[model samples]
Target: MEIPRRLPSQLPLILYLFFIILHTNVATTDTIKVGDWKEILNDTLVQDLGMYAVLRYNNSTGSNLSFYAVFEAQAQTVAGLNFRLALQALDADFPRLYKAYVWEKPWENFKNLTSFEPVLG
Candidate 1:
């Protein structure tokens, strides 16, 4: 079989691009405990500024979350659930997500798609 003359020249560029993509996605997740949170949450959020209005306390579930560790875990779990929910909501834009929902082959890298739906709720 005859090979294209340009194939050899493009090989290095292809390999370079592959390595660039691989290295760019290599990120480490750091888990910070609630006790160490004083440093992280210091004056960053709006709530840190002033004394907010008194929130009504309704003691329903026994999980008071008085211990910050419990609060952190609950917060992380809610955030993770919200992320998955957002992903599912994205699928809803395509077609009947409630009917024949599709679980696609997930990609490691992020993708961009645009959709618009009028807000009713």
Candidate 2:
């Protein structure tokens, strides 16, 4: 089997477009904002979850909303004990599109955390 000679010609153009799109986040994309967490509601005697989060969705329709009460995990005697929660929606007043996500990890692993792109929007 031989590789298509034409495939190489399009490789550079493909990569260039990929990066350009990233630099300029096209419209219709939602952004996530993290809030402060305080007071653990679900205490396990080992880990206390603090709920102080809100997801704000900017709407082109001027019906923006915020989802209150997020998630936070704090632990002792553990090196990696943390997590994040986010709520995403296509628009403020629409019900056809929305998403919720959670990511957990240790404090030391934050450096290796994935970069932001699009979670639910």
Candidate 3:
């Protein structure tokens, strides 16, 4: 029996679809939550490696009292990528009530102060 060959025009489309399907299946959909913040901080390995750090703020006396936590992760390599991914997941899952900013330094040296600033009426 003779075999039929695919035309060159169809190869690109086929490959594109294959990749789309493969990527969709492998894509991570997990998101981080408020509780996960504690876990990330308590991780000794991450701390020792200097891969991640966090800054926390609490207001005891104020009309608009709130607790703010900024999580920082050093993204120098593949592990850093994971750290960033986890951070993003947390942001997506925990929808910050107060202004929250995520930074990747030294590219993003300054915090996004605009979010913290109160909007003037």
Best by TM-score: 1
Candidate 3 lDDT tens digits, 2-116: 7777678799999999999989877865455322432245255444222222222122222332222333432322211233212211233542433322333334443211113
Tell me how many clashing residue pairs each candidate has: 0, 1, 2
Q: Return whichever of 2 and 3 wins on TM-score.
A: 2
lDDT of 2: 0.35
What are the clashing pairs of model 1?
A: none
Worst 10 residues of 2 by lDDT: 45-54
lDDT score for candidate 3 against the true structure:
0.35
- Local distance difference test values of all predictions, in order: 0.25, 0.35, 0.35
Candidate 2, residue 102: the lDDT equals 25
Candidate 1 vs 3: which has more TM-score? 1
Residue by residue across 64-100, what tens digits does model 1's lDDT show? Answer: 2121110111111221111111111122233111111
With candidate 2 superimposed using the best TM-score fit, by how many Å does residue 45's alpha carbon deviate from the native? 35
Cα deviation of 76, candidate 2, in Å: 26
lDDT of 2 at 37: 35
- Evaluate model 1: give its TM-score: 0.24
* Model 1 per-residue lDDT at 29: 36
